[model samples]
Target: MKKWLIYTFAIAILAVLALQLFMFSTIQQQKNSDEKYFNMAKQEYKIFVPYIPDSLELFGENVPVDHVLVRERLENEIVRNMYWHSHTILLLKRSARYFPVIEPILSENGIPDDFKYLAMAESELTNAVSPVGASGVWQFMKSTAQEYGLEVRTDVDERYHLEKSTNAACRYLKASKQQFGSWTLAAAAYNMGGGALKRDVDAQKTNDYYSLLLNQETARYVYRIVALKLICEQPFQYGFFIRNKDLYQPIPVKKVSVSSSISSLVDFAAEYNLSFLELKNVNPWLRSDKLVVNTGKTYEINIPLSFSHTKLTENIADPYTIFKDSIVVE
Candidate 1:
C-alpha cells in the first residue's frame, strides 16, 4: 500500500511539471506570434518627413529659402499642411471648383496666379466669416470690403460674392504691392494690415519681408501660402493621391439679369424650376429671403445650367483642366 501511494505521488509531481512546460511553450508561441505582427505593422505604416524643394518661388519673387529661418518656417508650414490630411484634401477638392472662377479674374487684374493660394490660405475657398466680422472667401472686413468697392449692406453684401470679392482682393493686393514694393510684404500686410506692416518695416529699417520681425500670425502667413502652393501644385509628392473624378468640378451656370425687385425669392426660384436653397447657394450675396433692386440697378443672378431653360443631355465636362497640367510627379 505504501509503495502504491509513493508511486501515485511521483506520477502527480510529473504531471504538474509537464503541465507547466506546456503552458510555458504555449506562452512562448503566443509571444513569438505577437512579435511577428508587431514587426509587420512597423513595416506597413510609415510617417515620412515632407520633402523640401531646394528652390521655391511665390508671385515671381524668389523665396530666400537659403536663409536658415526662412527654410525652417517653410518646413513648419509644409509639415503642418502635409500631416493635416483632412483639411488639405478638402482644400485640394475645393480648389478645383473655385480656382477656375478666381484665375481669370486675377489674370484680368494683373495679379499673379500665386495669389489664388493666398485666398486658399485665407478662407479655404469657402464663404467663411471670421469671428471679427471679416466675411467671404477673401475674409474682408466690412470697412475694407466697402473701401474696395464691395457693396456691404443689409439686403446685399457683396463680400460673399465670389467674383466681386475676388476683384476687390486684386485691387487691395495691387495697392499693397505698390506700397510695400514686394509681393511678400504685400501678403504680410494683407494679414497684419497695411498700417501695422508699414510701422514694422519702418521700425526695422528693412522692407524685406524675410528680414522684418512680424507678429506670429503675419510671420507664418506667407510661408503657409507658399507651402499650400507647393503641396497643391505637386500633391502626389506630398502623398495626396486623389482620383480626378473625386475632385469637385465647377458647376455650370447661366446668368439671369433682373432689373426689378424679387419680392419672394422662393417664388422666383420656383418660377425657374429651382429650390430656394439652390438659388441662395448660387447667390450667397443675396442676404435676405427677398432681393430689393433699386431704380436702374440690375442684379445678375446665376442659375445652374441644368436648372435653367437650356436643355442638357449629359453632364458637363471637367472645367478644371489646369490640375492635369499642374500635377507634378516625382
Candidate 2:
C-alpha cells in the first residue's frame, strides 16, 4: 500500500512540471515572434523630414525661421507627417499620380510651383467632399466655383472637374495676389476667403498672413503645405519607394463639347463608342445619368481615348478603366 501511494504522488508531480514547461515555452515563442515583427517594422518604415529651400518659405511672415513661434508651428507639421505613417504613405503614392496633372495648370496660370502643396492641404489630392458641400481635389464651394467660371448646377458640378477647378483656383490665386501683394497671403486667402483675408490684414495692421493671429485651420494651413512639400519632394529620405508601374498614371481623354440637352447620358456615351462606366470614370463631374444641358452654355465632356487594353475591339473581360496618360480638359 505504501509503494502504490508513492508511485501516484510522483506521477502527479511530473504532470504539473510538464504543464509548466509547455506554458513557458509557448510564452517565450510568442515574445520572440512579437519582437521579430517590431524589429521588421522599425527597419522597413521610418519618417524623415528633408531640407527645405528658404526661397519657398510658407508661413514665416516673410521672416526667417528663427522666431520661436514660427519654429514651433513648423515643428508641429513635421512631427504630424512623420508620425502619421499610413496617411503620409497614401499621400506619397497619390501624389505621384496627381502631380503631373496639377503642375502644368499651376505653371500656365503663373502661380508659384510650390502652390501644388496647397492641393495636398486642401483634399490630399483626393476627390473629397466636405460637410459644407465643397467637392473635388481643390475643395471649392458652390459660389466659389461659379464665381471663378466653373459651371455648378444640379446636373453638373464642375468643382468635381479637376481641370476646370484647378484653373478656377489659379484665377482666384492671381486675383488674391493682386489684392494682397504676396503669394503666401494669396494661399491663406484660398482657405479664408478673399474678403476675410483682406479684413484680417487691415484689422491686424500686418500684411503678412503668418503675422496675423488667425483660427486654427487657417493658421496651420501654410505650415502643413510647406511640410508636405518638403516631405513629398524627397520621399527617399522618408523611406518611400515603389515601382513605376505601381505608381498611379492619369487617364487619356478626348473632350467633346455640347450646347444642347441630351435625354440619356448612357446612350450618349454609347454613341461615342464609350461604356457608361468609362464615360463616368472620365467625367465624374456629371452627377446624374440624365443630361440636362443649358442651350447656350458649352460643356466639356471627356471621353477616354481608345486603348488596346480597353478598346471595344479587344475581348477585355472587364470594362474597368485604368488611368495611363495625363490629359486635361481645359
lDDT of each: 0.86, 0.75
lDDT of 1: 0.86
1-330: candidate 2 lDDT, tens digit per residue: 999999999999999999999999998767753355445546776545544444546532353466668767876886788668788878876876678888899899888788888988899888899999889989999888888898888888888888888899999999988998888988999998888878878989998666889878999988888778767766544444432333445566778888888789999988988888889877889989877876577888888886443343244222122112221111
lDDT of 1 by residue, 1-330 (tens): 999999999999999999999999988767753355445435645568888878888999999898999999999999999989899999998997899999999999999999999999999999898989889999999999999999988889999999999999999999999999998888998999999999999999999988888899999999999999999998767867554545776767899999999899999999988999998888999999898999989999998756432233134343222244443212
Residue 174 C-alpha lDDT in model 2: 93
Tell me how candidate 2 scores on lDDT. Answer: 0.75
User: Which regions of candidate 2 fall more than 4 Å away from where they truly are?
Assistant: 1-42, 47-63, 272-275, 306-330
Instruction: Please report, as a residue range, the 10-residue window in candidate 2 with the lowest summed lDDT.
Output: 321-330
